[model samples]
Target: MEISRKNRRLIHTIVFLVLPLTAFILFVGFPLYWIFITAFKPESEISSRNVSYWPREFTFANFGEAWKNAGFSIYFKNSLVMTLIGIVLILVVSIMTGYVLARYKFKGKSIVYLILLCTQFIPGAMLLTPMFIMFSRFHLLNNVVALALINTTFQIPFNSILMSGFISGIDYGIEEAAQIDGCSRVGAIVRVILPLLKPGMVTVAAYGFIACWNEFLFAFMFTTKQASYTLSVGLKSLIGEYAMNYGQLAAGAVMAVIPVTILFINMQKHLIAGIGAGAVKG
Candidate 1:
């Protein structure tokens, strides 16, 4: 009877834990595996009727062609500039907004919070035409600054709310103590509360960075010039009028993914830790 009980327990463990893990590994790993294999596959193998799971002719030639002919170097620099600028602006603005919302009690605060929540539901597609028109009126079309501003506007509300939660997690007394030591409100935040919010800040910054880096719709709409094209836009350009360059497309994807993947893995620990500490008092 005890042996039978152990058998049932083992079955439960496999069903609850092992099966899901195995499934996750396959789902996530398969795409990366596919891209990696396809990136190395020669054009003949890719376009052939018989598609092999592995590449027949693995080549470094694809990477060279992607960097040069695909204009990925230009795309890489543009993406880096836009992402960095947008993320910096987002964090700076979100942190301040979050601090005010979390630490202070004021009139209309709940209304402001509700409005922010509402913005989340507004589809990006809906905003595209209006935003394009607005930017065009200002003659900001095809500008990196315009793209960065648009990305930051779309990103800020959520990151601000997130930052508020991080701020709320810390005790108010710490800031008060800093105040007692002759620090101004700004100084207290910079010296005291900001340090404690590092984990949350990292999470927020990562979210903003990733969003801006991978954003295609706004990037595509805002910039018509190839010089201003981001990685996503550049990658999209790889799709031809007649025949696509799948190998170069895959190589560009792999190249585009490398920096963001490295950043995410490095900061994922902080991200998880920050998330575990919720913003709402409840």
Candidate 2:
């Protein structure tokens, strides 16, 4: 009877938890595994009918080809610059906006919140034409700065709400203490509040980086110049109308995944903390 009961419990655990988790892992991990393996495979093997689970021949040639021949070098640089600039702009604007919403009581505060909330529901595609016209009028077409700015604009609404949650989670007494110690409002924020906000800021930055790095439509439509193409656009360009280089395409994808992967791995702890704190208080 004891052994039978133990067996039933084990079965229940497997069915309820282990099996589901394993399935989820396989579902998410298989594509990434395939991409990694395909990236190393030679072109001949890649296009071959034989479905090998592993690469028949490993080579770095694909990465080299993608970087040099496919112009991923330029794309990589542009993505890095644009993502960094966009993150900075996002952090600044989100922090300030968040602080105001969290700490201040002002006229039209509810309306402002409603407007910010509504902006989140607006699709980026809807604004593309008008944005294109505006950028054209401003002579900012094919510009990395302009790309960063647009990305920042799209990202700020949610980030501001998130930032407000984080700011609200922080104790007001801390800022008051800083002020009592001869720190002005700006100085208190600069020295005390900002340092305390690091985890939240990191969370915001990670979100901004991912959004800016993966943005395809804006980067594609706004920049016609090959020299101005970002990694997302550059990857799209690899799809030749008639024939595509699967090997180089896979290689470019792997390259694009690296920075964001590293970032999440490093910032995972802070991300979880920030999210938990925000959820509790927001």
Best by lDDT: 2
Model 1 regions lying over 4 Å from their true place: 1-20, 272-282
In terms of lDDT, the poorest run of 10 residues in model 2 is 273-282
Whole-model Cα lDDT of every candidate shown, in order: 0.87, 0.91
Candidate 2: stretches off by over 4 Å? 1-3, 272-282
Question: Can you write out model 2's per-residue Cα lDDT over 1-282, one digit (the tens) per residue?
Answer: 356988999999999999999999999999999999999999999999997799878899999999998899999999999999999999999999999999999999999888887786789999999999999999999899999999999888778888988888899999999999999999998888899898789899998998899999999999899899999999898885468999999999999999988988998886666557544433
Question: Looking at model 1, how many pairs of residues clash?
Answer: 1
TM-scores for the candidates: 0.90, 0.93
